[model samples]
Target: MIKNMKWLLLVSLTFVACNNDDSDTPAEVPVVAGSAVFTKYIALGDSFAAGYSDGALFAKGQSNSYANILSQQFAAAGGGAFTTPLMLDNIGGFSSGGLQVPKFPTRLTFIGATSSPANVPGVSATPITTHLTGTFSNLGVPGAKSFHLIAPGYGNLAGVFATPATANPYFARFASSATTSVLADAVAQTPTFFSLFIGGNDVLGYATNGGVPTSQDPVLGDDITPTATFNFAYNTLVTTLTANGAKGVVANLPYITTLPHFTTVPYNPLTAKSIGKNNDAVGLATIKLLNAQLYGPLKQALTALGAGDRINLLSETSTSPLLIKDETLPNLGAQLAAIFAPTLGAQTAGAYGAIFGQARQAKTTDLILLTTKDAIGTAPTAANSGLGIAPAFPLNAFGISFPLQDKHVLIPTEIAEIKTATDAYNVIIAAAAEAKGLAFVDTRSVLAQLSNGGFRFGNFTMTSSYAVGGAFSLDGVHPSARGYGLIANIFIDAINAKYGSTLRHVDLALYPIQYPLTIQ
Candidate 1:
C-alpha cells in the first residue's frame, strides 16, 4: 500500500512538472458536415474492454466500455460512429442480501452452489452471455486470445461465450454463422482510428489453469499461446490497424493475479490442517513459490511433447486435474516428456515438496495431488477416501464443489514474469503509437490507482473491496459498469490531451454506485 502511495505521488509530480506555466492550448481537428469524419474509430480486444458482465449487455454496460465511451467522445469531437455488435438481454428482478444466500461461499466452494452463484433471490433467467458479429466496432471477444481474433470460425468456440448451448444467444440473434471473424470485419471497414486491446486472454488461459502448461490434444503441444505468439499477433494486429491510415491506441495486459479476483479468499492454513491461522500468512507465501516451480516444470514438459501430443493432454486437464480421465492421466507426464526428454522426470512429482509443505501450512490446497477420479467425482466408491487435500468432503471428492480460496496472488517470481511480459507488450504498444503519432494512454497506472485508491463516482464513492463491493462483479477481477466508466475517463483524458479534443467527461453524478451503509 505504501508503495502504491509512492507511485501515485510520483505520478502527481510528473503531471505537475509536465504542465508548467505555459498554457498554450493546441488546435482542434476541424469539423465539417458529417463527412465520415474521423478520427474513423475501431475497437479490438478481449472481454474487459468488451463490457461483459452482470447477466446482460445493455446501454449502460455498453456505454461503460472504454472503447465505446471514448468513441462517443470522439464522435462528438468530429470522429465517426463506433459500431460494435450489441448483445442484449431481457429485464428481470431478483432479491439479494438474505440469510439463505450463504456468506460468499469461500473460493472453489461455489462450483455446485448453483448456476447463478450470486445467491440472490429468485432464478436468473435472462440471456446472460453473448457474442458479436458483422461490422462490430468493439472486436473484444469475451474469451478470445490474441490469435483467436483471427482464427477461422472462432465464433463457434464454446469457451468464448458462456451458455447452455453451443452458440451464444446474442450471436444467434444477429448472426446465423459468421463467414469472417470480427477482426477481419473491422479490417475490411478501413477505419481511421483503431484501438486494439488484444493479448490479455493469451496468458489468462494459462493462469486460469492454475499455471498448468498442459494442452488439449496429444498431437498438439502447449495449449497456452506462448510469449512469441502473443508478440507476433500484437505486431500483426497493429500493422493491419495502421495499414488503413488508422492511428490509435492499444492497451497492454495487466498482472492478472493482482486483481481482487485472484487475491480474495485468503489462504487459511488451518483449513488444510497443515498449520494454525497464526502461520497462515507465512504458509501462503510458501505456496506461491511452489506454484511458480510447478508451472515452470509443466511448461517444459509440454514443450518436449510437441504440439499435437500436447493438445491431447489438454483435453483431459484444463482447469482441474479431476476432469481428466484416469487412462489419460497415466499418459500425461511421460509420453510428452519422453518425446522431448525423459530426463524431465527429475522435476515431476515431489519436485517442490518443501514448497508444497509450506503451502500446506498456508491452506492453499489446490495443489494437493489426489488420483484423477478422487479429484473429479465423489469418494472413489468410498474405498479410496479420507485422503488428498483436507476438508475432503463427500461433495469435493465427487468433484461436485469447487475448492474455496483455490486461487492466490502472483508470487514474487510469478509477478516478475508477468511484469516482464507486460513490459514487453507495453513497449511494443508505445513504439507503435509513437510511430503513428497517436495518443498513447497509460491505462495501467490509471487502473492501479482505481484498484488501490478509491475513486468517487458522484454520491457514491466506489472502491475496490476485494469481493464485497459492487465496483467489481462476483468474479472479483472484472469491473462493474461504474468501474468501467471510471476507466473510460482515463481514455477520454488522453484523447483530450493529445488531439486537443474537448469531449465532455462522463458525469460521475449521473451514475452513482449503490453502497448502502447499514448500521450493524
Candidate 2:
C-alpha cells in the first residue's frame, strides 16, 4: 500500500521514506517463552489438531497441523523437538491395511477448470495396522472425543474391529500400548506446557449426520455427548494435565453446524435446470411429471389432513425446496392413507401413508448436507426404497419424488438440539479453563466470524464457503492448511495474553489452501 501510494503522489515519497529506509522498520520483537515453559509441550485434540484436510489425514496435512504450527513457533522459544505420528504417504486415509473405501477414504482434489472437487482415485498408503515406534508430541486423533482421550483401550489394535468400534485407528497406529489412553501417553511425556482442543468430535458427529442425535459410525460413535459426560471428561483432562503444574491452553467448542458441510447445500436447490441437468426443457418435463404424479396428490391429501404445509407444489420459474424426512413431525401416513385409499387401492394407500408420514418439504432454516448434493436428483436403490411405493407412483427420485432420509438434512428441531449441546459444552470448557487458569481460545467466535462476513488476514479475507472460501477444504467440514495457520495465530494470541508469552503468529500467506491432485 505504501509503495502504491508513493507512486500515486510525489508528495507521498517523503512519507514513505520516513516510514521505511530498512533500518527505520521497527526492531523484531525477540521471541520469548515468558513465564510459560516450552521445554516439553504437548497438543491434545481431534482432527484439527492432527491437521486433517481435504477429508483425509495425510503426512503433509499432519505437518501443517496447528499443533505442529505452534511447535514451530515454540521452537523459537525454548521448546524441544516436537514429533508427529505422521501418515506414511500423502494419501490421507489408510490405504492398505485391509481398510475399506468411504470409511478410510482418500483425500479430495480440486479440479480448477471445473471448479469442483473429486476423490483422489485411491486410498491412503498408511494403514491402520502400521504401528509407530516412538512417542509423539502430536496426539491429535482425528475422531477423538473428550471422553475418548481418557478412555482405556482407545488405541488397542484389536478393538478397532469391535462393534461400535472400541478403538480409534488413528490413535491405535501410534499409541504407547494397547491399554494406554491418549492422556496416559501425553502425561507420560510430562509436558511442561500444552494445548487442549477436545470436545469438537463430541458434537460434530451429531451435527454432520444431519442432527440425528446418535450415530452408528464405526469410529467416532457420532453421538452428542451428554452435558454431564462432557463436563466430567473435560475436568478430568484439565485436572490431570494441571496436576503436575503444567500450564496449558484450552479451546471452547464452536457451533460446528455452521461449517460448509452443513451450510453449503441450499434447502431449496431443486430447480428445473438441476433436475434436467441443465436442459431446461427436459427439466421442466421431469418437474411436471413429478408434480402431476406425486407432489400434486400428496399436497391435496396432506391439506385435507391439516398437514398441507408439509408438501409444496413444484414450480417452473423458481427454485423448489427439497423433500426431507423430519422425524419430529407427527406421522400422518395413516391419515394420508385413509384419504387416498378411497381413490387408490388399500395396498397403494398403505404405501403412501408409510412414506409421507414423517416427511415434509425442507425449509430455508433447514440445512441440507454437502454430501447429499450428488444424491439430489439421483434415484434411490431398492434397499433404500423401503417405502414400498408401487411402480405407478414417482418413487425413484431422491430429494424430489422420494423424500430425503433423516441423515441427509438437518431440520430446525435438530439444529436447536445441537445449539443446546454446544452451548452447554462451551460453558463447561470455559469453567474448566478459568478454574485451571489456562489460556482460553473462544473458537466459537473465530468460526462464527468466518461464517458471517469473514475476518481479514493481511490482504486476504477468509470465509467458510467450502472449497472456494480459502478457510475450509473441499470436504466442507475441516479447514484448509491456511486455516490451520490462522488457528495457530489465535492460539498464539491467547497464550500471549494469558501467559505473557512473546510467541509470534505464523504468516498465513505461506500456507496452501489445497494440495495438488497427485500428492507426491
Candidate 3:
C-alpha cells in the first residue's frame, strides 16, 4: 500500500508540472487583423504632422513625428514602408548656395541651471541639393492652411522665392511640379490608410497676429478660413480621400490661447517689489516721487474719466498692471500730450504723445505672448529715444516708457474673436467626421486636460506648462518627441475604436522629454 501511495504522489507532481508550463507560456494573443488595411498609409496636415519642433523642421524631428510613429506600429501589423521628405541634418535651418540662412531660429535649450531658455542654432544646415526623389508617404506641409491644400501652384518654387503669399517654400522643396496641389499629391498616392489634422493655421494666424483680421473676404488669403469655406474644403478632402475606399482619422483644433505661447507670461508680471530694490521705504519714496512727476497729471485725467484705478502708480508694493494699447481710450495721445505740455514744452510734449498715445492697463483677459517677455524692459530704438521726458527715462523699453503694442497683447475682444472661430470650426470638423465614418480625435479636450493638471501616459506625466511641461518643445507651440508619442497613442486608440484595428500603443518613456541640441 505504501508503494502504491508513492506512485500516486509522483503522478500528481507530473500533472502539476504540465499545468505550470501552460501558465508560463500562455498562447500568444492572436494579432487581430483589423478590418482596415494599412498597406499604404499616408499623412496630411500642417506643421504638427510635419514634425515641426524647436521652431524648425529637421531630420530627427521628422523621424520622431507622430505620423512616423504610427507608421512604425502599422508596419508591425503588416503595413508597408513609410517615407518623408527628410531634412538633411539635425541643425534645423536649410542652406542656400552653401551658406546657411535660417528662415526661423533654432530649437530651445535650457541655459545653465536656471529655468530660463535660449534659442540654440542647429549643428549643421541642410544643403539645397538634398532633395527626396519619387512619391513620398508623409505629405505634411509646415504652414499649409485649409484652402492652401487645394490651391494650385502652392508649391511653385518661383512663387515661393518671389512672393510668400503665392506659394509655400516648404512644399516647394518636394512638390512633384510647380502646379501640384497638396491634396492632389496626397490623393495620387492611392493610400490604403491616411491621417489628416488640418485647420489649426486657419484660426491660428488670426490669434497670433493679436486678432488682427486679415480680410473679410475668404479668397483674399491670410484670414481665418470662413466656417463655410472650411466646411466645404474639409468635406471635399474627405470625399476625395475616401473615394477609393481608404480609411482615415481626423483631429480637431485646440484652443490656441491655451498654448504656452500665450500662457507662459502672466498678464500682471510687474510688481513694485519685483522691479528693483523697492522693498525698503527709500525705494518706495523714490518710486512715489517719480510717479508724481511723470504720471501725476495723467492719473488725475483718468480719474476724471472714472478710470482712476487703471492708472498704475509705481509706488504700490503689490503687482502692477501691464501697460497696453487701449483703442477705447479716445485721443489718448493728445490727452496725455495736453497733460504734460505745460511743464515739458511742446516739443517734449509731442514726444510724450508718441509714448503714452495708446497706453492703457492690460486687463485680466489680456494674453501676453511668450515672445514679448524679452522686450519688456529693453530700451527703445534710437529714433524714439527723444520721447522720454529726460535721460533718466526711456520710452522704448516695455513697462518703462513704452506701452505694449496691439501685436504683443491679445485684448479681451481679440480673445472673443478667437473663441468664436474655434467653436465654429470644431463643430464643422465633428460633423464631417461623423458623416464620413472616420475616427475623430478631440485635441481641444486633450490640451485642456494638460493645462488643468497634467496628462498621464504609462510611467510618465506631462503638462502644457512651458519648458518643464515635458510635452511642448522649445517653441512652446509644438510637442517634444515624448509628447508626439503620447499623441500617437491617442490616435491609435481612436483608430482602433473606429476601424477595429488592434494597433499597439507606443511607450512614451522611449521618447525623450527634452530633445538635446544634438540629434541622438
For every model shown, what is its TM-score relative to the native structure?
A: 0.58, 0.93, 0.88
In candidate 1, stretches whose alpha carbon ends up further than 4 angstroms from where it belongs are 1-39, 55-60, 90-134, 156-179, 216-224, 269-359, 363-416, 456-460, 467-470, 512-520
Query: lDDT-based ranking, best first?
Result: 2, 3, 1
Tell me the whole-model lDDT of each prediction, alpha carbons only: 0.48, 0.87, 0.76
For candidate 3, which ten residues in a row score worst on lDDT? 383-392
Rank all candidate structures by their TM-score, best first, as comma-separated numbers: 2, 3, 1
**Cα RMSD for candidate 3?**
4.8
Per-residue lDDT tens digits of candidate 2, residues 175-205? 9999999999999999999999988888788
lDDT of 1 at 55: 31
Task: Put down candidate 1 lDDT per residue, 227-274, tens digits, no spaces.
Answer: 676667777777777786666766655666555555553432122112
Clashing pairs in 3: 380-396
Please provide, for model 3 over 101-196, each residue's C-alpha lDDT reduced to its tens digit, 9 standing for 90 to 100: 555445567656756676665444665434455888888888777778787888776775553247776777788888988889989989988999
Task: List residue ranges in candidate 2 displaced over 4 A.
Answer: 1-23, 97-102, 111-115, 213-220, 386-393
User: Which candidate model has the greater TM-score, 1 or 2?
Assistant: 2
